[model samples]
Target: MMNNKISVREVLVEDAKALLQIIPIIDKETEFTLRGEGEFRLSLHEEESFIRNILAEPRSVMFVASCNDNIVGSLGFRGNNLTRYKHTGEFGMGILKQYWGQGIGTMLIEHLLSWSEAHDIRKINLKVVETNIRAIKLYERFGFEIEGVQKNEVKIADQYYNLLSMGKFI
Candidate 1:
């Protein structure tokens, strides 16, 4: 059982250390994400700089979910700087394994959709490993549709997994 309430909010520079700490843990817990165990190696200063950059970018935003002020999950949207593609962006998210099935991902997506609409974002897209049915279902519940598939896109554990491209129009 969870010991505290879960909340989602815009990420802050102060979250750099906690964010950095949780990311590799989540990576080790799941294969759905692109990164694997021991693959995330961002220094504290670099993480702080990254949060600052995201905060300064008009077309990009990042949010983190906390349980009792402990960062447990994160969601981020990366929009294009080019005027022609500024209305569209791709998002990626991750949550700690223990928090799964507790509506944390849903909370993050709701927050992202609300923020995207206010920021004039017309479309959002994401790519997921084909074997990740749980994530695919979550995205589909939020109105994302599979637009295409990239065969043999990611090779993990000596096996290749297809990547599904999904998008939603706001």
Candidate 2:
């Protein structure tokens, strides 16, 4: 019952509106999490600039998942800047709240994996909040391992949280 009708494609500058819908989803989801406390608020202008930066970089790529003409998720990978780590790329992803748990995140990660291989990105890494078990498990299923914990890393709402760094080799 899987449908390829849900399309994943490179994100374009014109997709601002479609992608904007997911920002609130991210905000609300992370609001209760350690990163969303009173600090690190997401801004439309910042996100817009981020999209442009990723698109402008030569060794970076961004992708969006769309269904029935609406974007439901987005992901990206940026090549490591240091020459010694050039084969490695950092990655991240987010899905609209309504579309989560329906395999959108899974498919998005899978698609990114293939894209990484094609672009010679040999490794991918990201950091997740230690309390987010679901996301940690999802990354585990994709062959990512817990690299380490960043102690007292993020201060959210008057509390501190650890960031569990995770990574995978393509």
Candidate 3:
């Protein structure tokens, strides 16, 4: 078990470098994410710009989890500014392999929920690979319902996998 307390906070421009390092590591550790190993190639300047943009958008937010001052997880929500879609947003998250089962995911979700409620977000959505049962269960536990499935949404190693679209209304 991890003895260090994990802290989750909004991403800062200064985190760009650390994010560049950790994101690809997480990608390499899990097939559940869309990007494969060594596929995350955001340059430091691009990452900093992205962070600035996210911060400037009132309906969008990104959070990072740190333990012992090291970033180990990240979560982000992106919402549309259009009137028709302003109340809903989609979120994505990732955690380092060593930090799995350490409640970091739970903290991130809780923070997102609180932030969504305060920001007038009515619904939250996420997509997960169908075979990722652990993630599916976690979403379900948080009251997200599987709204639909996309067949063969992802191809890996010459095999196809389905994707589950899940949502929760705040």
Candidate 4:
């Protein structure tokens, strides 16, 4: 989806280097994810290896949103490897806090859902901090429903928070 000069597309292996550089920054700048600042510590080689694995997976995808060639956001899905769970997938996404509320989140989810449907994935699952009301609302807008809550699943700083388990079936 394109609006206000933001572009989204599948990430390529060559993007691993740039992605590795920016991922930690994004993690550090966002409080809505499982990882806190500087928690996503990975060597360049490790990140490259990880990206290669994601690229090699037949039922997984990583999409990035960019503005002027700088990566601003990412959304991804990983399908289950087990034969019995092959029809299911899990997703994760994050946008640079500075770029929030520009409709980028909606575009990412839309892209993933369309890709999931085309890939024949029947179910998609995700988890969000219960306090992340904006993300919860966005997911709900796209048909995701809360299935359960893991009480006190995340502890940030001096406080604990619940994690909302959400899913959507195509």
Q: List the global CA lDDT of all models.
A: 0.94, 0.78, 0.94, 0.87
Q: Model 1: runs farther than 4 Å from truth?
A: none
User: Candidate 3 clashing pairs?
Assistant: none
Ranking by TM-score: 3, 1, 4, 2
Candidate 4's error at 5, in angstroms?
1.7
lDDT of 1 by residue, 74-131 (tens): 9999988788998999999999998899899999999999999999999999999999
Worst 10 residues of 3 by lDDT: 1-10
> Residue-wise lDDT of candidate 4 within 21-73, one digit each (tens)?
77787888878876888788787788778778888998998899887677888
Model 2: residues >4 Å from true position, as ranges?
1-5, 32-49
For residues 1-170, what per-residue lDDT tens digits would candidate 3 score against the true structure?
54797899999999999999999989988999989888888899999999999999999999999998899999999998999999999999999999998888989999999999999999999999999998898889899999999999998779999999999999
TM-scores, all models, native as reference? 0.98, 0.83, 0.98, 0.93
Clashing residue pairs in candidate 4 are none
Q: Report how far off residue 44 is in candidate 3 (Å).
A: 0.4
Question: Candidate 1: lDDT over CA atoms?
Answer: 0.94
- Over 1-170, each residue of candidate 2 has an lDDT whose tens digit, in order, gives 25535778888877876667665666567642333423444466776787899888867888899887788778878887688887888777777666767887788888888888887788899988888788899999999999999998877668888888899988
Residue-level error in angstroms, candidate 3, position 86: 0.3
- Model 4 C-alpha RMSD vs. true structure (Å) is 2.0
Decide which is better by TM-score, 3 or 4. 3
49: Cα error in model 4, Å: 1.2
